[model samples]
Target chain A: MDILRLIIAGSVDNGKSTLMGRLLYDSKSVMQDQLEAMEKHSRSQAAGCPDLALLTDGLRAEREQGITIDVAYKYFSTTRRKFILADAPGHVQYTRNMVTGCSNSDLAVIMVDARHGLVEQTNRHTLIASMLGVPHLVVAINKMDLVDYAQERFEQITSEFSKLTQGYTFQTLTFIPMCALQGDNVVQPSTHMPWYQGPTLLRFLEQVEVRRHTNLSEARFPVQYVIRQQTSPDYRGYAGKIISGSYRKGDVVRVLPVGMESVISAVEVGGQKVEEACAPRSVVLRLADSVEVKRGDVIVKPDSLPTTTQELEVMLCWLDNKPLLSGNNYLLQLNSSVVQARVGQVAYRVNVTTLRQEPAPEHVAQNDVVKTTLHTDSPLPHDAYTCLRENGGAILIDKTNLATVGACMIQ
Target chain B: MGTHTLDYLEELESEAIHILREVAGQCERPALLFSGGKDSIVLVHLALKAFRPGTFPFPLLHIDTGHNFQETLDFRDQLVERIGERLIVRHVEDTIQAKALTEPSGRFASRNTLQIHTLLDAIQEFSLDACIGGARRDEEKARAKERVFSVRDAAGQWNPNLQRPELWSTYNGRVQKGQHVRVFPISNWTELDVWEYIQREGIEVPALYFAHEREVVEQQGQLMATSGLFPQGAAAAIRRRVRYRTIGDMTCTAAVPSEAATVAAVIQELLATRVSERGATRLDDQLSEAAMEDRKLKGYF
Candidate 1:
């Protein structure tokens, strides 16, 4: 079965956790003993149902404050597919946490309260999800019970959401109206809403086609390590995962940055000889000649070569408390490669609400999304983030504190 | 499909292998924390797949609580010998003796907390910048909030609020002089996923995971093995056919009644069970509501 990684995003009181709990509970994935524990620890229970939100609030501070601060992953499997849900915090100050959750997700579940139509937080989350290239989106207009299960409210909310995502490139956009607390239209269809004619949220998640964005035509393998056998002095193997594309024995390949060409001598996965290996599989390959290949070097097909340059234009999401200024140096870590780099120019900051580029600021603070240029001390092999995310994404690490300060998507 | 697709197990394995390579590529000195349990055993198997044909860059470290089962110890030694990799064993007993620590005395006393002292000491002794553990987020609540590369201070304290944001697959492994990062490659795997992978790969674990006749001390709907260190004064020990869901200090880990002699049978039983792995088998976690979070703050794994 395929595994689906989804993130639930909303404002603080939009019931993201309740939706997750309802999903697990209704699917019967919540064990009996765990349910009993949750009930025993629950301090408040309204409407005679257990406080399902307590199940995801695992930390002490979160339990005390009754809010989610970071991302917490929960796992459950149905007959059709397995799901890995990332419950991200909804507060505006925790946008980095939301970005972290959206980075690897295949789908985004944007939660909205029907009582209040699309708000600024909803727009921000939708924009971040679009920026991160989440293929599918399911906008859940929650709390239908509070809105008297009105069909007009649901339609109004859906219309506003459609207007907000006018120019976004989401592959699939679905809108569902439900009450997560009353178990209506989440796992089971609501008995109160006879006007609605759509699949329940669970049904949509189970049937949605989430394609793996692995590019097989243009192979890109960044060498992570070099293995040289001690007993067999003649054996040298380059070990790494194929970030994109495939490799076969006897195929001629090029090693990047070093500019050496060699024929593929052998291919091995998990220590056994294989005829070929594809993207995302960790394998070791032997070159016909010893061409001085080392870690941080990209091995790819000669015809579809990646950009080899020292300057790059990138869209960066600043994640640190310290402000990011121009001409500041940090370590840029790409897939299996790290190089010293400096922030050259802040071109523009994105106005998330309007999806427009504003004037550049002197310093960018935490959770600021900016388009900028980066200069590396050494040549880097990369692709556009829109083309191949695996080869294009990079993170900036602080030089003194060693914290990841920025996430850069190569433009 | 134009692009080649992998099965769910294969995908999880690939993700884990990628994380292992990151540890090898980033950290200068790292160690794989090995136990005789199935999770760490699977870690060893993945390590072989990751760095085989070449020797492992780091050694395997085990913080023995001195309250372990003999079968697990023997299995550890044999596996290390078979792989021909360096094994570093640090004893919590030695730490207790050297530091004049008092052992918890009760019906079910455990050295679970004391093992942290030895683990922290081993890190400083070897100057290990990274320690790859077999912790899965699906196991417990606090771990579910943990990052794949969890950073700890020089004193080995974990401040959940200060956790650095981990985005995508890129991990920041840089740390200060006495600090180290705890990397969990199998963070995404659940208990069922681990068992399914074990069945798929045909990896061997300790014999205790299967059903066997042993004398166990029954208490509070839990069954713990009768060991020398266990104070079994009033509670009667009886022979029962049981199996362990997890492997830990004998004083703390419990067994469940089962007839799962094979991996497939165990996976089948897991699917039909109601209680979670830790909820059904661990004795130490029943101490309080925030037991794991508290232990993590005090440098306990």
Candidate 2:
């Protein structure tokens, strides 16, 4: 069966949860007890009827405070496909949550309040989705019932969102006008908005192409473990998850930095012998002969291998409260390797709203997207994160506190 | 890739095997949390494929709730015996008896939350720095924000806001002296993938997973099984057809009416089904807005 992973985003009180709950409810994905609980919780709040958004706003503080704290996952299936919706919070403070929600997401289903059109939070979420490089987008103009489900109003919001999303790398942008509270354009075909002939949210979600690659080539295997047995003292193996490419017994592979070459004598993991292993696969390799490989060294094919370097240019989205300090050292982790790194230079910063690049800042604030250079203690095998993120991305940690403060993609 | 090779699922299996190897290699003392559930069973099979031809570098651990289904216990024992690996089983009731836990009462009572105590105790007992669980992100809303290598505080609590973002395959398993990491290799796999993988690999699962006739009753609009401990309410016993959406404490777990009698049929049912597995069956989550999160903070698995 086909499976799709999409991220749902909207401003505070824009019915993000309501839209999600509507989709789930209309799709018949909600169980009887859950529906009853939601109804009970909703009426107790004295808001007339229970909010369908309560289904996903599960954080007690979020429930009590009436705001989404972080991203919540919702699972449902249509007759044709299985859908995993990553519902992200809209508050600017929780932009990091939205980033985390959208990281591996295949599509972005952004919602706009029919009454308010596009607001600051809408721009923030849409920008965050674009910055995370989400491939597909659907701007659901919600609350159409309040606006009379008019085609003119729907077109107004769609153009506004489209005007802001002009220069980006999205595959397709769909606009569906509907009132989530009234069940229009969510699951069923909206009778009120006949001018809008596009598929409903469920139909659009079912049809969205969600092809993602794991980069199963070039064969980067960093040694996370070194194996030795008392029975076979001479036998040694390097174990790690494959970042890219395929590896098999008899294939000649190179161990990084030390530059030792060897043939794969055997490929064994969890006691089963396999002929080969590829990207995203975790396995152990036995060399044709003994090799001195440790936890930090990487093994890869001699050809199509990555460039090893001490310095890198990165597109970074700072995710911490303390901001960026150039003098401070942070531990950089990419794949199975970890090294000491420093922010060498903040080349420039970009304005998410205007899509304009400005001169380098002295330091970055929270939610600032910047281009910077980093220097590492050791050479890192690198690829452009946009091209092959599994091998090309890294997280910067506050060395003293061990807090992951920033995420960087190799440029 | 072999001819007639499985496409994405096989690739996913290979990826999981690689993660298993990394866990074994990177951590000094690593253990797999075997529940005898389909996910854990699949994990064991993947583990066997990960460290073949020698004794695995790690041991297998099961945090027994003592309220476990007898079939699951039997399957657990049989699998452990067949694998010939060291199996460490810790009991929650043992902790209750030790005064380490104050048991809950009423229909709301569950050792499900108590498994955390036994689990953390076992982790300390074995000095295991890495404990692998079969938790998938799709199971609930709170689990979605989880890191593949989730770090727990000394108190064994997960802070949703304090997670290290795992953008790529880069996983950080580092923690302080008393703190440990809970690694989930199958964090990305959905319910469908798990079922499809099980069916594809012909992996052995508990008999309860398939179609089985059992006395049940409708409680709170859910079909509660009538077992030794959990009383079947006065609802009629018309056994139309059914299967379990989730397997948990028999006292609270619910089942659904399904004609799916085989693995392939079950997969088809899952594909055609609109509601989530937990959505259809979980009674415990119906209690609070952040039920899963609260339980997780209290060290629920």
Candidate 3:
């Protein structure tokens, strides 16, 4: 079965966790003991029904504060597919956590409270999902029970979200009306709203086509480790996951940034020889010639080499509490490559609420997305994030504290 | 057909290999935490696929609780010998004798908690910058919140509140002096996934994982294996065909009555089992709701 990595984003009280819990509960994925524990905890708190939100709020602080603090991942599987759900907090301060969830997700389930319709947090999350190039989106119009499960209210919210979708570029957008608390269109179809005809959220997730969003036409392999036989002096192999495209025996490839070319001698997966290797599979490739490949070096098809440059223009999401200052040095880590980089200039900061570009912000503050230029100490092989996410996406770490400061996408 | 769709097991294997490679590339000195359990066995296999032709860049470290099943120890030795890799074993008894740690004594007394001291000591003794473990997030609640590259302080303590943001697959493996990182390559995998991968790969696991006739005693609603370490008089012993879902200390690792002698049968049994692996087998986790989280904060792996 295919594994779908999805993220659930919504403001506080929109029932993102409840929606997830409903999926697991109705699908019979939640174990009996865990359900018993949740029920007991809910009764102790005098909740009318088993508090589904308590299932995803695992942390003690989150339970006490009744808010999600960081990204919490939950897993479940159906007969057709498996899911890795990332529950991200909706508070504006925790946007970085949402980004962390979106980084590996193929789809974003942005929940909107039917009463509030389209809110600021909804727009911000949609924008971030668009920026991260999440292929699919499911706008869950949650808490329909509170809005009396009215078809007109769902339609109003759906049309408002449709207007907002114009600002984002999601390959597929879907709208589902559900009450996560009462188990409406979330898992079982809502009998309360017979006017609406659509698949349940669970059915949609199982049927959604989670395409492998990699550039299979352009081969890009970043050598992570070199394996050399201790006994056999002639054995040499380069180990890495193919980020894009494929490699076959005798296929001519080039070691990037160093500008050396070689032929693929052999490909091995799980210690056995394979005729071909494709994107996202970890394999060890033996080059025909010893071309001096290192851990951070990228190998690609020689005919379609990426641009090698010392200067990079990137759109960065500042994650650290420390504001970004121009001319301050940080470490830019892309794939396995780490280089000393300094911010050259801040071109513009995105006002996520208004979707406006504020020109030349004084300092990039926490949770601010800014377009900036950076100068690295050494030249590196890279492509724009739009061209190749595996090779283009990066993270900036503080030189002193070593905390992840920013998420970068090469422009 | 020239399609590139990977099965669930294949996808999990690819993700694990990627994580292993990242740890090898980033850390200065790393070691694999092997326990001869099925999970760590899979980890060793992935490591071999990750860097073989060559020996692994790091050694294998095992914190011997001194209360282990002889079968597990023998399996560890044989596997290490077959792979031709270095193995380092540290004993919890050493710390107990040194007066650095006091073993818990009770009806349910086991040296499981004391393994943390031995593990931390081993890390410091070997000066390891990173230690790769085979922990899966689906195993526990706290584990579900753990980052793949979990950073620990000088005291080897885990602060769930203050973890660094891990965006995409880019892990911040930087650590200061006396600090180290714990990398879990199989964090995304589930128990069924592990069993399926083991079956698909035809990997050899310990004999204890399969059903066998063994002398066991009923304690606290769990079937504890009665052996040389535990006399039959400790509890009422009976012969039963059983297998272990997880392998830790013999005192803490319980057995489930099953006739699943083969991997395929074991998979079939697991598909019908309701309780989690730890919930059914581990005796220590029954103490409280936050048992795993509390143990993790105190530096237990």
Candidate 4:
């Protein structure tokens, strides 16, 4: 079975955690001991129900506050597929945490309450997921039981969400009416909603074709570490992960920034020599001639080379509590390369709630998404994020604290 | 990497290898926190794939609790010798004597907490900037929320609320002069994934993983091997065919009754079990709801 990395987004009390808990519990992922503990904890509360939401609320502060503060990862598997669920916070203040979770997910499971319909949180999450380039969207109109299992309510919510997402692009959009609290249409089909006919959430997740999204035509390999053999002094193997596309043994490759040309004499993946290495595989490449290649260098096929530039336009998400200013100088890291970069210009700030671009502000505060220009000290070989996400993504590190301050998607 | 389409195992392996290399490329003085358990064993194997044909940029560091099984120590030594890598061992007993620390006295008094002190001291002594651990996110609740490159304070304390936002494959391994980072390379792998990888790669583990007849005692619904550390030779002690699900201090790590002797059988057995790896084996986690979180905040691995 393949892997599916998914993120579940919803507003508070929208039953996001309940939906995740139902999926894991019905799939036999929750153990008997955990069930017992949940039961014991449940009895202490007033509701006295099996509080499945407590499972995802791992931290003590979250449990006490009864909300998710950070993105907590949960894992489960079935015979059909393995799942890695990024349970993101629903609060508007934690938008950066949601972006962090949505950055690597293959699909986004967005929750919309049937009663409230598409609220500000729903549109914000959808916009952020779309901005982060999440391929698929699953709009789960949860808590349908409270709506008397009305098909019209589900349709109304779906249409509203569809209209809200009119400007965005998703490869696949699926609508499911689920009562996560009642275990309806989550792991098993719902009996109350007889009018609704659709695959359960688990079934849809298992059958989603997400692996084809990997870019195979544009080969980009960012050199991470250069390995020199002590036994053989002349062996200089470029160790790095093939972020996108593939490289063959005899393929002529070019070292980026330096523009040095060489032929791939050998490709070693997983410690074994292979004729060709594909994307997402950590491999070591042996060049015919020893060129000036080290960490923070890219090796790509000469035919499909990325744009090498010192000036880059990117969509930046401010994560740190400190606002990002125009003159801020942060350490910009793209793949293996790190360069001292300065924020050049803030073009416009995209309002996450309405999905609209407004005038640039003086400073981009926490969780604000803005289009900006960055000037790096050294030239970087990168692709547009829309064309190839692996090579286009970057992060801005705080110079003072060494903390990751912002996330950048090259445009 | 061999086939055009990688299975889940291969994908997980590739991701882990990438993380391993990131630690090597980012940090100047890195070390692999090796315990003789199956998870760390798989970590060592992945490190070999990551930096073979060239020496690893890091050495293996083991924080011994002194309440270990002889079999595990022997296996650790043999593996280090065969791999021809540097192995540094710091004993909790030595730390206790030097610091005049008091040991917890109980039926199964674990040195698990005391080992944290030894680990921090060793890190300071070696000035190691990066410590690559074998912790999996699927192991515990707090661990599920941990980042791949978890940064710690100068005192080696983890601040869960102040974690950095880890985005994409790009990791920020930068640290100040006094701070250090704890990197988990196999954070995505589950317990079953480790066993499956062990079976697939033919990675050697201690014989305690397989079923063997040994003197055992049942305590709090867990089957623990009878050892000198916990001298419970009363009516509760009985000989049973058992195997350890996780290897830690012998005083706290429990065993389960199983007949699986080979790696394939162990995988099959794991597939049939409903209890979690740590829940069924480790006793320290049973103390509180946030046991792991509290321990992590105090610098316990």
Could you list the iRMS of every candidate? 1.8, 3.9, 1.8, 2.0
| Model 4 misplacement above 4 A | A43-49, A61-69, B1-3, B231-235
Give stretches of model 3 more than 4 Å off.
A43-49, A61-69, A230-233, B1-3, B227-235
- Model 2 over residues B80-156: C-alpha lDDT tens digits? 88988888888888988986568777664667777788888887888878889898887876787667778777787
RMSD of 3: 2.1
lDDT of each: 0.88, 0.76, 0.85, 0.88
Candidate 4 Cα deviation (angstroms), residue B188: 0.4
RMSD (Å) of each candidate, 1 decimal: 1.8, 4.4, 2.1, 1.8
Q: What are the models' TM-scores?
A: 0.97, 0.84, 0.96, 0.97
Candidate 1 regions exceeding 4 Å error are A46-48, A61-69
After superposition on all CA atoms, how large is the RMSD of candidate 2? 4.4
Ranking by TM-score: 4, 1, 3, 2
Model 1 Cα lDDT, one tens digit per residue, A1-411: 878989999754999888999999998778887888898888885646888887787588666756444688999888888889998866645678778898889999999998987888888889999888788999999999999999989888888789888988898999999999888999999999999999999999999987664666788999888888867556788998887888889989999987889999999988899988877788998999889998899999898999989999999999888999899999998987899999998989998766789999889998889999999999999998878778888999999889889999898
True-vs-predicted CA distance for residue B148, candidate 1, Å: 0.8
The two-chain DockQ for each candidate, comma-separated, is 0.67, 0.35, 0.62, 0.67
**lDDT (tens digit, per residue) of candidate 4 on A1-411:** 888999999855899888888888999999988877777766446464668886776588566656444677899999988899998776645679888998899999998888888888887889889888889999999989888899889888888888888888898999999999889999989999888878999999999988532566688889899988756456679899898888888888899998999999999975679888787888999899878899999998888999999999999999988889898899999999999999988999999887889999988999899999999999999999877878888999999899999999999
TM-score of chain B of 2: 0.93
